[model samples]
Target: MPAAGRLLAERHKDHRKRHPLLPAEYEDEQLAVVEVTALWESESASGAVLLEDSELTGYVLGAPKPSPVWGPNLWVEAAGQAVREPEHIRDLYAAAAAKWVDDGRTVQYVVVPDDADLLDAWFRSGFGAQHAHAVRPAPTTRLEPPAGLKVRRALRDDIAVLAELDLVLPKYQSRSPVFSAGELPTLEEALADWEESIDDQDYATFVAEYDGRVIGMSVGCSVEKSSAHSGLARPDNAGFLGYAAVLPEARGHGAGRALGEAVMQWSADTGYTAVVADWRVTNLLASRTWPRLGFQQTFHRLHRAIGY
Candidate 1:
């Protein structure tokens, strides 16, 4: 389509509009057009381009294996451009989803948070917000623990306690309408995850203690710049934060804050320049807490499930 470049340009422009603080790279639409067009050269990629009087009005490209988080389904790997024009977006998705559904795919995921019109189109086509990724510079704050508590790297024996903290996230999300409800992981699953983290040299796990009782936990690890989308994090020397939580009874006691500081401390000590993390938007506590700790929203993962 002659208008493909322009449509993709609109996508980049819309993204930068949604995130005003985004780095200057996002302002370069030509680069975005190059990246998006390259996906279409893949053999498995498929999509539709709508035209009104021979001008591209909308387009979508779907591909398998774009990510593991969305399960075994076709991801809307790249899509945008004139989507908000009446039924254009819904029609494009309808055409794309029909083929995937017939081929036995059951889910579709797309990342498009910065465009209100595009998001509205997605909502009209059955998509809902699922995840939010946030980032910030490695903090230098002098976070000291409360008088009765201390924070330090968690030992292997502390695996069980860290697993308990991991459960809080699922429990919190289960009650929030905006997040998918699901069964809590078994203790075995939680332990296995923590064990993998502990064994990885690049990862660090921390816990907060009060009178020798563990009250909170956090995990930090190196992140691959190439694996993350452009502009989501700095292009180099980045880190990723995993689960972090403090027990309900320990809310105001500084255990959570201390644990967070420990993660940032680990990032700095390990030579990382910035860190990334994600939390559900509907979880009221996290919605308030993460921003307060300086994590700025970078991208939103939108989900749509048309039952098989």
Candidate 2:
């Protein structure tokens, strides 16, 4: 585990060098060791390690998620891999995939750092980008809301409207390029969820209003509260922009951006140094908007399925 941690620490350093905005805490060797050990010791863990001259050079591991959106899937978590050479990952995956497939886990996903050569290696291994995690410094200034639109922290009174707005993103994803088949939460479920979140001190919900009607919404919370952002990609003292959606009629306007800015401002005021968010790679609007808002891609979730 110590050797694996050393390799991971080096990989993280390389990532930070290439993307200066990345958080520095992950480069800590001890933290990397602990994270790798947790995955390596999991009951269902399956992996491969490369050794040269009796020294560890690379490793890959994966385990099944408790309940995944995809069937019988294994996730190669953010801390699940490190390699001395980019091409060595191909060999690691080949060994790991055989064990995983024999276990009936045909669908697989891996969270990988944002490096062209590394991504190219994964691409050659039959993986393609499915989702992305990104981060940026919290903005110091509040962004101006779109003309005639008011952006403010959400209140209990906005629960019904928030529930309606919540369906917008999933609805959009159900059509066209994304075509996500995940079940959409009912309005009652959304309402119940928002009711809890609105009063939760750890959560901050923001809404964009036009003519006294809510047209968009965004939610922010500590990174520690989000399973996706709280793992290997998490930064120290960071906040997560967990959810955001805008009405169809409000599309052309800057309501989404306004709500996003409001989240960033909330994160900044709440003492977070950085903010992180993630989106489906095929969600056209989200894929484009998040990067445009200054969120730099840090890790990409790549996926591949065999005999599905």
User: Candidate 2 residues 148-210, lDDT tens each?
Assistant: 989988889999999999899899998899888788989999889888777988888899988
Top candidate, metric TM-score: 2
RMSD of each: 4.2, 1.5
Model 2 poorest ten-residue lDDT run: 17-26
TM-score of each: 0.75, 0.95
Residue 152 accuracy (lDDT) in model 2: 87
Each model's lDDT: 0.69, 0.88
Over all chains combined, what TM-score does candidate 2 have? 0.95
Clashes of each: 0, 0
TM-score quality measure for candidate 1: 0.75
Between which residue pairs do clashes occur in model 2?
none
